[model samples]
Target: MLQSRLFMNLKGIGISFVPRYFFQINLSKIFNEILKYNTKELEEIQVRVRYYNKINQFFTPTEKEKIGKFPFKKTSYAFDAYEISKYFKDKFLWNKDFNDVKWTFKDPTICKSRPLENNKNNILLKLDKNRHFCFLKDDLIFENKKDIAVFRGAVYQTHRKEFFHSYFNKTFCNIGDTSKEASQYRKNFLSKKEQMGYKFIISLEGNDVASNLKWAMSSNSLVLAPKMTCETWFMEGALKPNYHFALIDNENLAQVIDHFRTYPKEAQEIIHNAHKYIKQFLDKKKEFHIGILVLAKYFYYSKQLDLNELGYEREILELIK
Candidate 1:
């Protein structure tokens, strides 16, 4: 009778019914049977259970140092500038002013010849001794020299090959703008790169988080997942598209790619598997429903109980039903 009541309650909740006898069996007895002769089975079961639990855990604050050492130096410098601006305001302001002055002065006098007596020997010497030094103007006065040094220091501090590549090489695609012109442009750009034998990866951005992730799965390419620091609306926008590459934010691209490259081989294989799964399941209604169901399970599990928190669970359940 108790088993029947439980099954009836589950059915009323729209869950499919299972045989009542399955629930009637003592769970403790089953567990003991599984562990009877296998001492290692308990440890293996614990590891898997813990792993699944961890996967459902809500986002916890983690120190960068705790995440493991990164393989590549950070590729983005924008955050470095932001960090410096925050803690060293005065120094940052001074550097900014110096950069403005140096660029304002040096750009106009790049090709002008000087008199033999006033040849740029001193400037050449400074350049030779310190590659960072450059003359802002011919006079090389204290103000000019100070400006040049400050600007040069900032430039040198920001210079990193990975940083430049992340900023310029990664492309951002917008699904809303996938007109004929945009399609042709992307086709041509990709063709040119292919012709040159340059490898590339694609990412998609959408208006819904799950949708954005779904699009990433569709691409079969490595993704640079968005950070929580980005605007929520923009993140949502990135997730709404069904068939687009993951759209990497300019600032986060370098960090994400670096993270992926440094990931353990097992992790990399899992990511590759996810990509393949996405590709194989794309446009399949049954798979889409399954994805939603899996997402709901994680969402509810993260909240520590079976109750729905996001309303997405109810929405998806309705759709699936």
Candidate 2:
């Protein structure tokens, strides 16, 4: 206990140390049992499981060596992957060193990728999980909040800058650039609770997928977002425009807002659908199952783990079917 506390304090000061046994959970037996039970709940978990880990190759040792190993403690982003890898009793080549890169990996590697770049090899995991996976509680109903839409975030990306330049002055929207570099466009930062006061919240992609998307969808307010160029464990690609969020670009921001404001029932439907989409992520037990399954599939395909070692390879085949 003393050693653990000391290590934590050292981590707080930017000195990082990861004890080898920290990620070993001995939960594979329990996980296998969960997989053995074929039910509606497990079916839902498998959908997300398939979405995260798409590797379907049998890589030789030589090919796996060429992919190169990424340092685990290089960043907090890599930490999630490192911890998960050890959870399954092995490690593999992975990259959590960068974000929003538009290239796909040729050899099997466990990493995140843009939606368009997502192929069988670029295995996705919930890296940087805290920043990307938050959900907010909202009590305000759509009919009761201010009708104006709100957008407050750093304005560095080309698309973000374009949206700010075009719609920041619009009457129906309250938008601001929060980056120091975008001082001229910057406005006071609005907390998540503060942003929920308005009826619509803009979710724009930054670096990769929009980090705000999960919470924005969880809120009572409707989300205003363009077509997603990237995706994560949230599976942004599956979201239907006009159903989950009102699709908006600079040209149609006002028009879409006007239509939704005038027809609140329609806006309420979008909110309902958004809430439905958010429900899948709310179950912590199923989420753990899905994460384990994703890693299981990843390791299995890469030839790291044997068929019997997963304890339910047949069950995985059936669940995936």
- Candidate 2 structure quality by residue, lDDT tens digits, 1-321: 357444534553342244434445565564665766558777777777767766555664334332223353534455555445556553454333246544576665556555555465566776666567788889888888998999899888888888888887778989998887836677898999999999999999988788899999999999999988877778888899999999988799889999998899998899999999988888766766676677767556656666566466676755543
Against the hidden reference, what TM-scores do the models get? 0.23, 0.86
Q: Cα lDDT of all candidates, in order?
A: 0.26, 0.72
- lDDT tens digits by residue: candidate 1, 133-233: 11111121111111100000011112222233345323332111222442211222222112112111333322212223333332323333433211111
* Prediction 2 TM-score vs. true: 0.86
Off by over 4 Å in 1: 1-22, 26-29, 32-41, 48-171, 174-219, 228-321
Q: lDDT of candidate 1 vs native? A: 0.26
Per-candidate clash tally: 20, 0
